[model samples]
Target: MTEVSKITLIGHSGWGPVEEAYEERLTVSAAEVTYRYHPIKATAENVAHRWRYWTDGPALVNAFENLAAVVSTW
Candidate 1:
């Protein structure tokens, strides 16, 4: 059997339904999907800070590094 690839889903807290459906579809391909929800207001500064934190923070950086792809809904 082929090994499943892991992917990261990053988006706002409001995208729960969309994420759920996408995750369900990805299951057919045996993908190991994970989600990271950010509830910050939709402002340029907030978005930039969020991305910088996710990409630079030790824990998040490590987790993101292992992901095959990153799907951002922001």
Candidate 2:
């Protein structure tokens, strides 16, 4: 398995933080990529759902690609 970098995706919409853990892991492919992406909501799911509206189509893919590129450079 490859190493994945954990990143916190925070935003006012709330989806960012909730999806941070999964997204970071998926993006980095690391085992223990811990992220603390939190929105105004108390539940992680709430924050994650926000991502639905915050990002659509290529936005998420583009963001993930950009993050992977930056990490590879580092």
What ranges in model 1 sit over 4 Å off? 1-55, 69-74
> Candidate 1 residues 10-42, lDDT tens each?
333335443232211121112223333333343
- Candidate 2 residue lDDT tens string, 1-74: 34434444433442445433332111122222233434344454544322222334565556666676676566
Error of 2 at 3 (Å): 11
Span of 10 residues, lowest total lDDT, candidate 1: 22-31
Reference-based TM-score of each model: 0.20, 0.28
